[model samples]
Target: MNVFSALRAFRELLPVLRPEWRGMLWSYLIGTASALSLAGLTVLTAWAVGHAVVERTPPGPLWWVLVIGLVLVRAVLTWREMDVSHALAYRVLARLRMALFDAYARSVPGRRREHSGYAATVAMDDIEKLEFFYAHTVAQLGASLTLFLASLVSASVLLPEAGLVVLVGGLVVASSALYRARAARRLGEQEQRERSALSTRIVDALGALREVLAYGLAPRIIAETDAATARAAAIARRHELLSQLVTAIRELVITAVVIGIIAVSSSAAGVLAEGAQARLSPAELPALVALALAGVAAISDATATLTRLHPLVAGAERVATGIGRAPVVSVPERPRPLPTGPLGLRFRDVSFAYEGRRPTLTSWSVELAPGEHVGLVGPSGSGKSTVIALAARLWDPLAGTIELVTPDGTGIPVAELDDAALRDAVALVDQEAVLFHGTVRDNLLRGCAPRSDADLTAVLERVGAAAWIGLDDELGEGGVRLSGGQRARLCLARALVRRPRILLVDEVTASLDPATEQAICDVIAGFPGTVLVASHRAQTLARLDRLVDVTDITGVTGVVPAGRTGGA
Candidate 1:
């Protein structure tokens, strides 16, 4: 990345703050007041000191009052500026997090290519690193520019020579920010990559802790993590060295500007030329120097802020990319409501494929009658899961339509239905029975309407989970504390809590013991609404009313009945 690219990245991200204009305005105003007050204090003290020393005049009560008041005002303004800017930054961060989450929700598992850990890193860590950009960069830069312009005008009015020196020196200091710009951006990007990779490794290790421990790979994992950390630290050290070099150059320029102002002030006061008429009074010399330095320092401060932004450019770009990801499925412009009553599922000549892979379903069609129970049976990797996912609208088929068929045989395309209505009508429980880190009730109530304790207890009882777990019992992260069967039952109860019109299960019983599997199958066997279970397990399929083989259903284009094969 270069300066231009960094600026473009920020340009893409800055629009997320449009809704916060009022807060941004307040932040800018407070920041400007703070910077001006500090400059005013410096100039006022210098003027009083010069007057007393060079003119033999004691300071008046008004001068003392102004100095004291400026100090107090500067302190308050400084604190208030931080409060407002940080508050505004956090609000923007929250919105960015939500925006990223929404993007992931729509775009994820598209081709199943994105790593969970990398996605988490982008959402949490990358977004967090942008706090400095949001909180300190924008309004503070504006405030610094405002102070520089104010001081320049004041110095020019006092003495044109002093103002000219300030302008030249400010430009030099500002230009220092561009020093090693390309190298800084490259190192920053490398650092970001290393950090994200390290986070991903750690997350992957934690998620597969049992396998790692079982294979005795802990030492190797630890060594690899240490190496990654060292690499990241080295990159950080290089960035720091470059920043320090720029700061050193900036400080040297500021020091030289001060010396130049002193010389100009002394010459105007007739100190360097004997018997020359004094154009500037000796008493104003200190104040003139102070004003010049303040003006130049403002420019330096702004440039320093810009220099620090190089390290954050990569993070900004990641966040921007994550937020702007192309959605896997398009939302309907005008969504039609689902029909009122039990709904069946219909796949019409559907053709789908994962990225870089052959088609999973080719011109295939299948349907379940309303209130009928059907089992989808096929060999492993025969697109049973793909069929279930399409019916649930996780991804749309590349060619053809999947619909929710009403009792009267009217088919409403799943893509055309309102998102909420579609979600309400269909529920899916897959092989990986995921339970979040929360109370049993929290996981069950996710995406469900409010349910009373009695209603929840009954659902848990239906799944045979009420015997071992209470509604308020905490399930550790990913239900680590629960047995496999227990987790499966709770997941089933969660799906049941929604009371969806169509229940889609995908090989959820493949790994369970025979007894537990039969217990789960019994619950599905009793569901009254339309049910479609995809499994290779004979016992699980035995509970359904009929079976449809995925391999036999491809190359067909019409509604195939639950028990029969269709023509190619």
Candidate 2:
């Protein structure tokens, strides 16, 4: 997208800030007042010099009083303008941050895989750059134009030739902003990409620091990061050089405008028609030049602002598209309550296909009765995990309905249930279940229903987790402070703390030893809840009430293991 369109998209992404608009208006007014005061000061100083040199008299007390009063007002308005604009910018940035977070929260683990650090850069760094656009660009541009117009009008009434010079100079400065803009946008986009890529690599390396050290890949990773940084810096250097060229062109145009004004005032051109009187007297020549410079300077500042904002269009488009992305699974406008009792999930002829992957299920139908402990079994890549995910409502099936049935046989579509209610009714503990950075108590609670320490302790003990860690004990990232088995147990305990009625487990025994897996199975066996576990291990499935071969559900002939039965 072009710069203007990108800017429009970014503006649309902002929360409706009626109050900020009002603040912007005030800021614009104060800023214009400040500019006019400075311009007026410049003109008055020139006029006073002229008066002293030509009229040979001390300046009157009124002129001094007016100058002093304007200086004080300018100082106050300058500070107030900065304060209001920056405060408004920060408030908008904060709102934008929240909006971005909410958007990601709704659409995350999105159909397309995006690096977490890249997303973080968009939400954090990209949004931060917009502060200058919001605070200094819009309101300041308006103030600049107002001052320019005021000066233009005043100068025109004094000397039409000088007014013409100001208009031409303004246009010239403004045109420089559009020059080579396509190149600027390309560089900006490349720079933005490299930065995000660098961030992603850094985050990935940090996340896998253990692996890096174990495999001795630190040097390679560091070298790659340095190369990425160098590429970004090279692009930035080119961008700076182009900007300098634009600045040089703009300065040349301003100098030409000044020289043109001086020539006209000195009658060197003598191009005016006969009987057309000069508007400016000889003594007022310098003041006229000063006024014209003020007007041109205002226009120059505006052009400079646009030039800087041009490089941010790529970042703007990203943040806007990210925030505007619709969630793949939409929430219900008016949710229907799930049935009251042990929750039983039913998938009715569901079909699902991941992006760029072959269809995993077609016309797949399955049923888990209330309090039924069912295991999903099949060969690897036979859609076992897919069934668990469908049950959890991570992404809605491309076709068909998944419902929760009550003990009394009432069926409520999972899609129609409120997000909170569905989460309360169901919990999943997959092999990848994560323990966030916090104390054990924080991990257990996680803003689920409030429970006392004794209650948390009891659930931990049930999951065989209480023996190791206390409620207040801290857990590092992903529970790296603990072993894999320990992490799994703590994760299971964390899920159990929610006391969900329907538990979905996906390959919870895939990597665990026989002892740890049996302990987890024992916890599942004793728990009086509807459980659906997906596993290939015969021993793990042997404990469940029955095993539903996923290959049979999908009608994939060779996908099922040899000698596998329909149900175990």
Candidate 3:
């Protein structure tokens, strides 16, 4: 992106700082004071040295005291400024992370196509890269500019010619920030992309480590990762080289400005000409040169900060995009309350499709009576899971409405209901049972109200998991220690702990052994509220009250009936 585009991206992030304005102000003030004190110290020391050398006058005790005091004060302010700015930056980053997570929560699994690894990289690594922009850029630039302006004015009062030299040199140093701007930004973008790709690869490999090892692909994966790392390192080296080159140019400009100030002061003090009138005192020459150097240094510091921003532009843009992603479903402006009592589900003329894919459902219509147990059966890719997901409100239908129905046939569209209310009433247990790395109790209580150990144990016993798994049993990451049947049972227990009014199961029995499958089906059959199971397993379907063929449910005129017998 160009400079203007990068500026706009950063502008979008400014609102996050509204609450921290006081901290930002204090940081700027402290930084400016610290910078000015250093400049003052440099000029005072130069003036004292020149006075002693030119006029045989020793420095007073007050001069020494003033210098020592400035030293101590600058040191304290410098530390304080850093502390405040870094703290403010960490707070902003924390806020950004939460915002990004919310965005993901609302928008993700919509298309079900985003790479988990890449999304993780954007959330963690890319956001972390923005610390320099938040902590150093704004307040430090202001401090540098203030120091430069103060030094420039002092130099002009002492000698206009020296001020002119300082101004020219400062302009030169500032312009160096724009040197190779497009190239630096391009390199930065490339580096960020490479890093994200590497992160994705590593995450994918680790996630499928078993498969990688079984297929004997570990060597290939490692080789590819090494190559990616090398490419990323090369890009970083190039960026550093470019930054060093710019620094060299800035240092050269500062050096030339110092030389110009010395010449101007010498000529004005009649040190360069035999009979020239002294426009400046000999003792002031050193102070004038010091002032010019200080001004140039301030501008150089500001420019250096700007140059660093070119590389950070890519990460900033990524973070901004991630935060501003379009949610899969919009929250209602005035959400209606969920219907009272047991909640049944009805999909009325509902139609949906994944991104760039054929329609999964077309004008589909179906209903589950309150407290009824129904099974959805279809061939692979026949939209069984899609129906389950829609019932759970993972994504809104592209057309038509899915509603929560009361016993009286009053229907409230899911889209118009409050999100929390919908989530509270509906629970989903899909085929892929995910158990986080924590105690079984932690996973069970994830989104539910607090439950006593007795209550939790009762639920686990209902799912036939209490025999092997206790409430305090530690489930390694993703329940790696458990068998497939064991994981499925725990997942069921987790859902049962919520005691939801409606439970949606998607192929949860497709891969389980008959004993586990029968156990899970028994629990669903006994649920007091509405139950919708999408499965092709004969044993699972046979237990349901009726079965509906998902392939033929769409484009039906009225409430879809169980077109096929469960055992058929």
Residue-pair clashes per candidate: 0, 0, 0
lDDT (Cα, tens digit) per residue for candidate 1, span 1-568: 6557778988887777678778878888999998899899899889989999998898899988998998899989988987898888899888889888888888764466778898888888978877656666778888999999998899889889998999999999988978888788788778888999999999999999999999999999999999999999999999999889989999999999999999998999999898998889989999999998988998999998888777678788888998888887789999998889988888889898888888888888888779877888777878999898888888888999999999899999999999998888899998886899999999999998899999999999999888889999999999999888888898999999998999999888988999999999889878888998888897887667677878875522323344334211
Q: Which ranges of candidate 2 are over 4 A from the true structure?
A: 1-3, 15-27, 265-278, 554-568
Which of the predicted structures, 2 or 3, would earn the higher lDDT when compared with the native?
Answer: 3
Q: What lDDT does each candidate get? A: 0.86, 0.81, 0.85
Top candidate on lDDT is 1
Candidate 3 Cα deviation (angstroms), residue 411:
1.0
Best by TM-score: 1
Model 3 is weakest, by summed lDDT over 10 consecutive residues, at 559-568
Deviation from native of the Cα of residue 521 in model 3, angstroms:
1.0
- Give the backbone clash total of model 1: 0
What digit string (tens of lDDT, one per residue) describes model 3 on residues 101-146?
A: 9888888644868788888887788777675566667788888899
Backbone clashes (count) for model 3: 0
